[model samples]
Target chain A: MDEAVSATAGARVPRTERGRRTLRLILDAAAAEFGERGFHEAGISRITQRAGVALGTFYTYFDSKEAVFTALVRDMSMQVRDHVAPRLSGTADAIAAEGAGLEAFIGFARAHKEIYRIIDEAEFVDQASFRTHYQSTVDRIVTRLRRGAARGEVREDIGEVHGWAIVGMNVFLGLRYGVWNEDGAPEEIAGTVNAMLRDGLKP
Target chain B: MDEAVSATAGARVPRTERGRRTLRLILDAAAAEFGERGFHEAGISRITQRAGVALGTFYTYFDSKEAVFTALVRDMSMQVRDHVAPRLSGTADAIAAEGAGLEAFIGFARAHKEIYRIIDEAEFVDQASFRTHYQSTVDRIVTRLRRGAARGEVREDIGEVHGWAIVGMNVFLGLRYGVWNEDGAPEEIAGTVNAMLRDGLKP
Candidate 1:
C-alpha cells in the first residue's frame, strides 16, 4: 500500500497521538451533526464547535464539508467492522460466528443509532462512498462464507446470494431490534436469526 | 372510510375515471423524473411535462414537489405489494409462498431498479414515509409468519425477528440480483434463498 497516497486520500495523516485524537473528535462530532440535521442542513462550524476544535483547525484535516462527510462514512464503516470482529472469536462454527457478529452489530447499532442515517444519506450525499461502503461490506461477507465453505462448516455454494441475504438480515434486524423498538434484547434477536440461519423455517 | 379525510391525507382524490387516469399518468411521470434527478433536484414542471399534462393540472392532484414525492413512494410500495401478492396464489405452503414472493419481487425490482434509490432517499427527504414503507412491509411479514405458525407450517415462535429477517433477506437479494447485477436468473436466486430458508446453511 502507498502510505502517502492513503494519507492524502482522506484527512491529513496526524503525526502525533494528540493529532489522532483530534481527528477522531472531528469525526464523532461530524456524525452527530450529520445525524441530527442531515447533510445539507448540518454546518461545519457547528461540527467544529462540537469537536472542540478551533475554526481554522477544521480545515487542517478536511478540505471541505463533503470531504469530511465522506471520511466519516468510511470511519463509521470501519468502526462497525472493528466492533463486530472481536465477538466472533469463541464461536463453535462459522455460522455461530455470524450470529455473534449479528449480535454485536445490534448492540453497536443501539449505541450508535445515527449510523443508519449517515450511511443512508451517503447514497444521496456521496455516491461513490455510498457504493464503496456496501461493496466492501458484502465483500467481507463473501470472504467469510468462502472460508466457511473450505472448512465444510457451511454449504459449499454459499456465495453472493447468501452473503447479501445475511447482510440484509443483520441490517433490518438491527433497525428493528437495535433502533426502532429495542423490544427484544440483542442476544434474543440474534439468537432468533441464528436459529433461522442454521435451520431453515421447515416445521 | 372517511372520503374527505382520506382525500386530504394524500393528493386530491380524482373524481371521474378520466381524472383517475390523469392522476396515474402524473404519478408514473413523477416516478421517472424523481428516479432520474432525485428528490431535491427534480422539479414540478419537469414532472408535469413528462406526464404530458399542463402545469395547472399538476396542482389539481399534488400540492407541491414534496407532496408528489410522498405519493410516489406510497404508490411504489403498493405497486410492489400488488406485484408480489398474486404470485403466492398456488404455493404448496406459506414457505413456498414466500419463495414465490421473492421470485416475483426480484423480477419487479429488476424492471424498476429506481425503487431502491427512491425508497432509500425517503429516509433523508421524508422520514415518516420511509419508516412507514418498511414498517408496513414488516407488518405483512409478521402476519404471514403468524399465519404460518397457526398452520404449523413454520416455527410457532416466529415473530417480529423472523419477519424482519426474511424481509431483509428478500431486499438484499433483490438489490444484488435485481439492481446491481443481473448475473443470476430470478428463479435461480429465489431458489437459492428458498433452499436456505427451508434447510439453512447446514451441509
Candidate 2:
C-alpha cells in the first residue's frame, strides 16, 4: 500500500537551496522514469541516476519506488487541480459552464497524458494508491458540483447522483482519450462528453 | 502488441467438440489465474499447469497470456449479451427497460469479476485490444438501445450519447462494486445504478 503524505511532506523544506533543487531533480527524474517505464519497471537506482543524486540521498526523502510513485501521484493531482481551477471559477450559463469544465478537464488530461497513465496503472501496482487518488479526484469533482448546486448555477435536478454520472463519463473519456487513445483527439472527445452532460444523452 | 491468437494453424479447432473442450479448459484456467493474481502477475505456465496441459499444448490454444485473455474477453462479451437478451425482449416500458438493462449488466459483471479485471487492465496492457473490445461492447449496447427506442420502450431522445453514458456508468460501477468491492455488494450497487438510470439524476 502507498502511504499518504501530508500535503506539505512532498515539498518539505530543504536545509539549503541546493537541497531543494536536488529534491525537485529527484521527483522530476522519478516522474519521467515512471512515465516511460511504468511503476514496476522504474527502479530506485535508475531514478537516482536520472536525478544525479546519491543513492543514499534518495532514501532521505522516499522509502522506495512505491513512495516516489506515491509522491508523483500527489504531485500530479495538485498539478491537475491547479490547471483546472482557474477555468472552473466564474462560469456562465449551464451550457457554457459544462463546456468550460469539460474543456479544462480534458485539456489537463491532454497535457499530462503520462501522469494519467501512471495513475491508471497505480490500480494494478497498488490498490491503496489507486483508491486514494481515485477518491480524491472524485471528491474534488463532487465538491465543485456541490458548489454549483448551491450557487443555483446548476440544475436542481442534477445533484450528488449527477456528480457520479459526470465522474463516470469523464473517467471513461479520460481512459479512452488519454490512456488508451482509443479514438478521436482529446478535444473532440471532450466536446462529445460536454454535449452529453448538457443534453442528457438525448440526440 | 500481443498476438490475439497463436500462430500455429488449426492448433485448436473452432466449434469442434475436442476444440471446444480445450478452449473451455484454457478459458476457465485463465479466469481463475487472473482472478488470483491479476493479468500481469498471472503467467501462462501457471494457467496451463492448473489446466493439466503441457507448455507447448497451452500455446497450441493461445499464443500468450494475452491471447487467452482476448479469448476470455470475447467469451465474457457473449455471456453478457446472453444475460441481457432475455430482459431486452421482455420489457416494453422505458423505465422498466432501462432498469432491466442495468441489472442484467451488473449481474454479468458480478458473475465475471475476473474477466472484468482483464478488460479493465486492457487499458494498461494493450490499447488497441482495449479499443476493439470497447467499441464492440458499445455497438452491442447501442443496438439494444436503438431497438428499445424504436419500440417506444426508451426515450426517443436517446442515441449514441446515451449509449456512451450508460456504458461509462456500468464500467465505473463494475470497477468499484464488483472488482474492487469498494463500498457495497454488487446487487445493491446495481439497484442504485438502476434507479439512477430509470430516473434522471435530478435531486
Candidate 3:
C-alpha cells in the first residue's frame, strides 16, 4: 500500500496488512471508476465490483461515494508529489531539478491519464480538495525554490509567484504532451521548458 | 452584440438589430446562469427569466440548455482574447506585450471572476469547447511569439511549448492574484512574471 493512500482523512484507517491491501484495492478501483464515469454517474457498487470486493467491504473503509472521491483526490495529489520528489533530490541544481521534476511529472501523467479528469472534476465535486491540491503543490514548489535560493542556485527573491508559474507550466505541459498526445519525448519537452526557465524567452 | 457572441455556432445568429439584442441578452443571461449554477443545475427557463425574455425568445436563438452553455464557453474564450489582443499590440516587444497581456488578463479575471468557474466547468459539461478554448488561445500566443521571433524580440525557436507555458502562467496568476485575492496589484504581479520571462531565475 502506498503511503499517500494512508493519509486520506475521508477513509477509515486500516488496522492490519490485509486490511491495508483491501484499502489499496478500493482506492485504485475508485480511481478507475471515478476517472471513467465521473462523480455524478459513478456508483459504489461498481467501485466494489471493480475492486473485487463486496459492498460491505467498501463500507468498512469509505462511508459514501463522495468520501471515496475526496480520498482519491488526496491520494492522487500525494502520488504526484511522491513521484516527483525523488527525481528532484537527484538533480544538480534548482533549474536542473525542475527539468527532472517536469520529466517525471509528464511520465506520471502519461501513466495515470485519469489523474487530470479526477483533479479537474474536484473543482466542482469537492472544492476544498481541489483548492488544497493546487495550494499544496504550489507551496511545495515555493519551498524548493527557496531552498535553491539558500544554496545560491536560484534568485534570492524566489517566492510564490514563481512557484505557481512553474506548477502551471508543468500541468499544461503534462496535459498537452503526456495525456493529449505522445508526439514529443518527455525529455525533449522538459529540456525545452528547462532551457526557457534557465534563460528567458528573450533573444 | 459583441463579435465573440456572434461567432457561437450553437446559437443561431440574429437577423436583425433587435434580434441581435435578444440573442445578446440570452448569452449574457446564460453566462450568469451557468456561471452561478453550473450546467446540470442550470435551466433554460431560468436563463430566459434572467435575460428578461420569454421562453419562446430563447428558442429563437438556442435550441437547448446545452446549446447556450456551449455558446457561453466560446463567447468567454473570445472575450479573453479580444480583451488582451490590443494590450499585446501596444507594447514595445513580445516580452513587454506579455506583461501587458498578463496585467489585462488579471484585471479581466477580477472583473469577471465567474469566468474561471464557467471555463473550468466546460471541461465536464462540454469537452470540445474546453479544448478548443485552450487550443485557440495557445495558437494565438504561438503566432505572437513567432512574430516576436521574426522581429528578433523573442527566441527564434519559440513555438507551441512556449505558448502553452505563457498561457498557463498567465492563467494561474490570474486565478491566484485576480479571482482568489487582490493582495497584489496587477501591475506588480505582471511585472514580476515579466521579469522572470525576460530573464532566467538564476542568481
Candidate 4:
C-alpha cells in the first residue's frame, strides 16, 4: 500500500516536484491513448507525443508501455478515491455519505468517461492491476461499512458481502447514468438508489 | 436480434441438427480459447483443435476470430440465462426467486470461472456484443421486476434503475464470491444480498 503513493506496480518513483509533474503528464497521456486506442494499438511514442514529453522522459517514470498502463490504473483508482473521499467526509450519516459518494462518483465518471474503457481494458492489458483495482475498491467499501456499523448508522452485522453489493450497484449506476447515458441528474439518480438502499424494494 | 439465434456478429447460421452440434462444439471451444488466451492471442486453429473440427469447419460457421469471440459472448449470456431462468421459474415468490437466481448465478460463475474473463474481454473485442450482453441481461431483470411489482412482491416503481442496480450487485458478488475467493457459499452470499435488498441496511 505504501508503494502505491510513489509508484504503481513497476513504475519508478519520481524524486522531485518536476519529476512528479512529468510522471503525471505521462499518465494522463497514457490514459487518453489507452482509453481511445486500447492496449494493443496504443504505442509508447504516441503516448509520449500526446504527453508533450520526450521518450526518455517516459523511461524516467515507467520502464515500458505496460508499466505506465499499470501505473495509470493505480492512479485512476486513487483519483476516484480522492474525488469521492472529501464529499463523503462532509456527510455524517452513513447512508447520506453513501448517497453523496455516489453522486460525486457519477459526476467524476461523466467528466472522465474514459475511466470505464480504461478500467475495463485493464482485464486484458494487465490482469493483476485489474484485480487489484477492484479488490482495493471493495476493501474500501467494507471498511466504510464496518465504520458505519460501529456508529450504529448501518446494520450491526453487515460485512464484506454488503460492501460488494453496494460497490456493484454504484459501479453499474455510474455506467448507466454517467458513462452510457445521462438519463437523470447525478443527485437524482443517487437519490433513487439511496432510497432503495434505505428501504427494501418491497411494495 | 434475428441473427442472434444462429450467429453472433455476422456469423453464418447452421442449417442442420448436426450443423448445430458442430456450431455448439465450436462455441464451447471458442469460449475455452478466448477465456484462457484472450481475444488477440486466441487463434482459430487452436479453437478448431479444441473442438476436434477442421479449419474449414470453423470457417463454415464463423467468418473470423472476432466473430467467434462475439458469438461466445452471446452464448455465455444465454448460458447464464438458461442456467438461471429455469431455477427462477421453480420459485413462486419473486423476491425469493431473485435470491435463487443469485445463488444459481454464483454457482454458474464458480463452475465457469473463465466466464468473467471472456465477457469482460468483449468490451475490447466487440463493443456491440458487450453492450448487447448487458443490455439484454438488464432487460430481463427489468421484466422480472415488473412482474414482481404486478404480483405485489416488489415495489411498483421498481424499473430499469433497480434492474441495473441489481445486475451490478449480482455481477460484482459473482466476481468476489464466485470467482475471486469463494469465501461464502452461493446460498449464503445470495441470502445476505437478498436480505439487504429485502430490507434497508438501517441499523
Candidate 5:
C-alpha cells in the first residue's frame, strides 16, 4: 500500500480521533437520512447538518451523496456476509442444517432490518450500481449453495433452479415483509419458507 | 354505476375519439419513458413531446407525473389480471390446466416486461400504493392455493407455507430476472418453478 497515498487520503482530515469520529458521524447520518427520506430526497446538506459537520468536510470524506450511499451498502453487505460466514461453515448436513441456517439468516435480517431496507430500496435508486452490489451477494449465495451440493447436502436435480428459487424467495420475503413491513416476525417467514423448501411447494 | 363516471373511469380520458387516442399516446409514451429512465428522471415535458401533445393538453388528463404513473400501473394491472383470469378458472384436478395458468402468468410478464419493471421499480415512487397493488394479487394466489388444499390436491403438511413460498418465488423471479436482468424467458422460469413445486424440492 502506498503510505503517501493513504496519508494524503487522510491529510484532508485532522488526523486525530475527532476526525475518525466525524467520519463515523457522517456515515451514520447518511444511512439514517437515506433510509428515512430515500436517496433522491436525502440531500447532502441534510446529511451534513445531521452529522454536525461542515458540508465541505463531508465532501472531503465522501465525494458525493452517491458515494456515501455506496459505502453504506458495502458496509452493510459485509456485515451480513460476516454474520453468515461462520454458521455456514460447519454444518453437519445441508438439508438438516438448512433450518438453523435459515433461522440464523432471519435473525440477522431482524437485527439489521433497516440496513436491509436501505439496500433493497436502493435498487430503485441507481439500478445499475445497485444491481451490481446485489449481484455480488447473490453470486456468493449461489456459491454457498453449490458448496453445499458438493458436500452432499443440496439436491442436484435443480441446483441452479433451486439456487435462483431460494435466492428469489429470500429477496422477496426480505423486501416485502422483512425490512419495513414488520406485520410479522422474520423467523415466522423464514420457517414458512424452510418448510416449503424441505417438503416441496405443493400448495 | 353512473354512466359518466363509468365512461370517464374506463379510459380516464375524454369521451371524444381524438381525446381517447391522445390519452393512449400519452400513456404509452409515459410507460416507455418510465421504463427507460425510471419515474423520477422521466419528465412531463419529454412525455408530452413523445406523445405529440401540447404541454397544456398533457395536464388536461394527468394532474402530475405521479398521476400519470398511477394510471399506467392501473391499466397494466388490469391487463395482467384480465390475461390471467381465464386460465385460473379450472378445478384443482386440472393440474395440467393449473400449469397452464403458470404459463399464462409468465406470458403476461414476458409481453409486458416494461410494465413489470414499472411495478417492481415503483417503490421509489410510491411504495405504499405499490405494496397494496401487489398484496392483493398475492392474496388471490393464496386463495387459489387454499382452494387446492381444500380439494385434497395439495399436501397436508403446510398449505399456506407453500402458498407464500410459491408466490414469493414467482414474484422475485419475475422482478429480478424477468423484468430487469432478463437472463431467460419467463416461460422457462415459470416452468422451472412449476416443476420444482410438482415433484418437491428434494433430491
Candidate 6:
C-alpha cells in the first residue's frame, strides 16, 4: 500500500508500521464484507469483526462505512496498478507489456474475485470512485500507449479511444476468464488478445 | 418485443394487440421507473403512474418489482439487439458490420442512457438476468463472427474470447462516448475502433 491511498480521506493516516498493518487488515476485511454483503447490507461492526480488531480500531482507521468503502475502492484500484506495473517493466516491448499486464490482471482477478463485485458496486455506492477507477485506468493506458508510440512500437494515432477499447477488452476478459470461470488459460487468453493487438483481426 | 421475452416469467403474456400495447406501456414505464429510482426504491404504483395506467394494469403484466426489472433487462437487451442487427446486415463485410453495430449501439445508448444503470444494477438485484444479458450478447457476437469466418471476412480463429473482447470494447465505448459524455462523435469513435479492429495497434 502507498501513502496516498493509505492516507485516504475520512480515515486517519497510519503513522507506524503496525498501524499500517492494522489498516491493511481493516481494508481486507472490508473487501470480504462488502464483497459478500454489498454496500447496503455490509456493516462496520462486521468489518471490524472480520478484521479481528476491536470496533474502536476500525474507527481509528476509518470514520464510517462509506469512508472505508471509498478507501477500499482506491486501495483495490492501486493494488491492480501496483500489480501490473512491475510486470510491464520487465516485458520485451509495449505490446508484450500489454500482454504481461493482461495476464497479471487476470491472475490478480482470479485471486481476488471480490474485486469486480466491490469495484462494480462503487457505481451505485460511490459514483466518484467508480468513475475515477475507470478514468484513471484508461488514462494510464493512454500514457503507456503514448510512450509506446514514442518508441515506434504503437501507432502514432493511438489515443483515448484505443485506451478505452483496450481497457474494456481486458476488463471483460478478466470477468469471463477470471471471476466467472477459469475456462481459458490466462497465457492463452492474453496471447490471443495480444495477437489481435499486434495484428488486425483480418485473416 | 419478441414472443420469448414478451412472455417473461412472472409476467402475464398479452394475447391481443391492445393487450400487447398495454404491456409495452408498462415495460416502458418500468424502464423509466427503475431507471430513475432504481429497483429497490422504485414502486409499482409509480410505474403505473408513469404509464398512465391503473395499478391493476401494471400487475396485469408484471407480478412484482423484480419481475418488471427482469423484464426491463430483457427488453433493453432486445432493444440494443434490434437496433444494431439491422445496421449489421447492410454492411459490406463482418468487420464493417461490427463497425456499424458499434455505431448503432452507441447511438442507442445515448438515447437510452438509463439502460446502463438498469443493466448494471441487475448484477446485484438479479444475477441471472445480468449474466444472461452479457452471455446472450456475447453469444450473438460469436455466432456473427463464426458466420464472418465462414465467409472469409473474419479470421477463422475468432471465438468466445474475441467475442467477449469486442462486446467489452463496444460496451465501454458506449459508456464513455455514449453515456458519460457526447464529446466524441459516435461515427468517429466507431470508425476509430473499427480501424483498430481492421488493423491492430502495431505501428
Off by over 4 Å in 3: A1-6, A200-203, B1-6, B200-203
CAPRI classification of candidate 3: medium
lDDT string for model 3 (A10-87, tens) is 998888999989988999999999999888899999999999999999999999999999999999998998999999
User: Candidate 2 residues B1-203, lDDT tens each?
Assistant: 22323211223445567766776787788778886788778999999888877888787776677777766766655666677768766664555555676666766766777766676676667666567667766777777666656776555555454566667777766666555564554445555555555544221
- Tens digits of lDDT, candidate 6, A76-95: 99899999999999777788
Provide all candidates' interface root-mean-square deviations: 2.5, 4.0, 2.5, 2.5, 3.1, 2.4
State which candidate, 2 or 4, has the greater DockQ.
4
Worst 10 residues of 5 chain A by lDDT: A3-12
Number of the candidate with higher lDDT, 3 or 6: 6
lDDT of 2 by residue, A1-203 (tens): 23233432444445677876787898888878988888767899999999998999998887777777877777776667677767866766454555576667666676667876687777777667668766776677666655565666544544434455566767666655655554565556666556545445221
Task: Encode model 1's per-residue lDDT on B1-203: one tens digit a residue.
Answer: 36333333468888788998998899899889988888988999999999999999999997898888888888888889989999988888777788899999999999999998899888888888888888889888788767877887877776778888988999888887898788899988888888887664222
lDDT by residue for model 3 (B5-121), tens? 447669888778898788878888888988788788899999899999999988888888888888888888888988988888868887888889999999999999889889998
Q: In every candidate, what fraction of the native interface contacts is reproduced?
A: 0.84, 0.18, 0.59, 0.82, 0.43, 0.68
DockQ of each: 0.65, 0.31, 0.58, 0.64, 0.45, 0.63
Question: Which candidate should be chosen as best, given lDDT against the real structure?
Answer: 6
Q: What is the TM-score of each candidate against the true structure?
A: 0.93, 0.79, 0.95, 0.95, 0.80, 0.95
> lDDT at A151 for candidate 2?
69
- Worst 10-residue lDDT window, candidate 4 chain B: B1-10
TM-score of chain A of 4: 0.94
- Isolated chain A TM-score, each model: 0.93, 0.79, 0.94, 0.94, 0.73, 0.94
Write one digit per residue (lDDT tens) for candidate 4, span B153-194.
Answer: 877787778788999999999988898887888999999888
Candidate numbers sorted by DockQ from highest down: 1, 4, 6, 3, 5, 2
**Model 5 regions lying over 4 Å from their true place:** A1-23, A86-92, A96-98, A105-113, A201-203, B1-22, B86-107, B156-164, B180-182, B200-203
> Stretches of candidate 1 above 4 Å error?
A1-9, A201-203, B1-9, B200-203
